[model samples]
Target: MPVAEPPAQPPTTRTTPISPSTPASPVRAAVVGTGGIVTGSHLPALRELHGRVRLVAAVDTDPARLTAFRDLAGDDVHGYGDLDEMLAAERPDLVLLGTPPALHAVQATAALRAGAWVLCEKPLCLSLAEYDAIAAAEGTEEGGTGGPYASVVFQHRYGSGAVHARELLRSGELGRPLVAHCQTTWYRDRAYYSVPWRGRWATEGGGPTMGHGIHQMDLLLHLLGDWTEVRAMAGRLVHDVESEDVSTALVQFADGTMATVVNSVLSPDEVSRIRIDCADATVELTHLYGHSNDDWAYTPAVHARDDERRTAHWRTPAADVPSSHAAQLDGFLDAMEKGVRPPGSGTEARRTLEFLAALYKSAFTGRPVGAGEIGPDDPYYHAMHGNHPDWAPKEQ
Candidate 1:
């Protein structure tokens, strides 16, 4: 696919922040795709912030699904069979995309060009090139601090536990992070792959690495900062699928932290987990799908256990906010209200996407892949598979 030309630069003037004394109008919002994610996650999130955002439109190719969504969204919401039509008619200020992974780049580019902000689902695009193109569409060259930016829905980063942990790590309160482990082990039987897009490279991107484990991996990166290199291995052990059902990687962070990452869909006993061992404390979060304050624990090192003040600081609780679509949406809405680029957008999101590409490259090539190595000229920059390895399952 040809890259989209960057849209005309808009005014760089910042909008005044929304204040309680001078209330601002609700943001006009539209949602694309009426799949399970739309109904189960995005819709409920929008409803939670009804006073701040109005669901002006919804789009879906499936007529039955569209009608069902419209019924649930009420008569005030407009429904469209096509995304372009909905964008032209509603001209929403925000576009929430719950579409398939293959469609994110095109849809997000379209919404950005239409002068709307976008909050898209995971595996934001197919490759690094696609991510760069979307960044360009967000007016990055003209300074990306203003309107019409795109943010990905890495909801795990917005939870209170994550927020607090990040602060401690950033402030050196937890000391230097030494060793870490991130896991996204969830079971998916053959029946789950029956969905045409579930296991295909062209459609679903990669296997559990891109689709399932990305959430926890993203959170790991969020707390650990940039990664320098990845040495990985992957295999299609159980299910008959084009992509690997299990992948394991040893990642090196720029901060001198070495970590292990595992993404799998073959584990019968399922869980999502991340553990970071710092000089002074060990921080661990274990949960499935989402996490909360209760799921996080902080343990002081043996030497520091005697220091009551230090231990208390590490254990202090922040407000209990679980990792959820709603929490992330609130952050996005805050950014929109302030007329600034939101978290999980542009380069920040690209980091996670790039890390995934590196993992795949390392797995397929049987070598370490480094940061900033895959550029426009690299095959992996255009597609995750790059030079397809013989070990990868042949597409049937």
Candidate 2:
């Protein structure tokens, strides 16, 4: 048997599957790594979804942070100094990961093997090897059949505008994808990396490409479908951090369309944006971090008809929700009850990770990297630095 010319991504779009509800009550949820993201996003979301979810436990190495969170969460939410203790005692239905990049794979897999659904933040482990392990541990059943599952927090996809855009493209309203652009350029000062983990291959992973721009690029893949190849370049251009402060890549999609990807933390003014040109119109979404309905726009092709009708069609979608972890968390919980893997779970979510790996592999090797090129045996597969053994950040 021969491999297809360019591998095709599974058309695993979000679908509602009727599932047998388990345990009858709101999902027993636990959160690990009680850092800024959890306190800022997921905890609040859980609070809002109070009727459908419950917070049972919290875990972190820092007792003081845990105490602060406990006070905010009230007396009922228990804080554990050790993750295993929390897992063994609570056996939560779901575990949300807000830990650093280095700890994601081990912690996420532990939760999954113990039979809890895992929701982790971006970068999703340091390399392809870790990603494969997490992917395998997610199990076969949608809701895991009493086992475990995992999902990365590509929260932007759950917004009302994003959901609406997906609807338009799937319905053929936007037409076939042709050209696109994705940019995640923001600023991070030297003080940001003063923490031990912010800028290293073994810890922080790749800089802007892995840590920052991943969300927008994932959104690009969300809209454009799978990419076939990437011709890219990266550098530790500005910041003295161990990873690239800036990087750029040109991506080729399996759909025969292409895109320009830019991820950087050097820009004085920051913006995250994605623009897709389809047969009928050009669709765009822009914001610094997350976006609401107000941040999206559509312009119909001049040669095409339905300008006024298109305006009405675009307005048809309800723009009630903004892009945030809360939105994706709601979807994750809903999917768990339906006994199906949530959006951004298993193989479905890792397309972005694979693309992420290819981008870095291309930059490090000074050539184009294809979808099937980087594998388990490749050096880049094991570590983000790959064979660039002597590479170092300036005056760190």
Best by TM-score: 1
Q: For each candidate, what TM-score against the reference?
A: 0.92, 0.91
List candidate 1 stretches off by more than 4 Å.
1-24, 140-145, 316-318, 394-396
Residue lDDT tens for model 1, 200-311: 8888888999999999999999999999999999988888888889999999999999999999998999999999999999999999988889998999999999999777
Q: Model 2 off-target regions past 4 Å?
A: 1-24, 142-147, 392-396
* Model 2 agreement with the true structure over 260-337: per-residue lDDT tens digits: 999989888889999989998888998998988988998888876556755578653664789888898888877787
Give the number of the best model, judged by lDDT. 1
> Model 1 compared with the native: what TM-score?
0.92
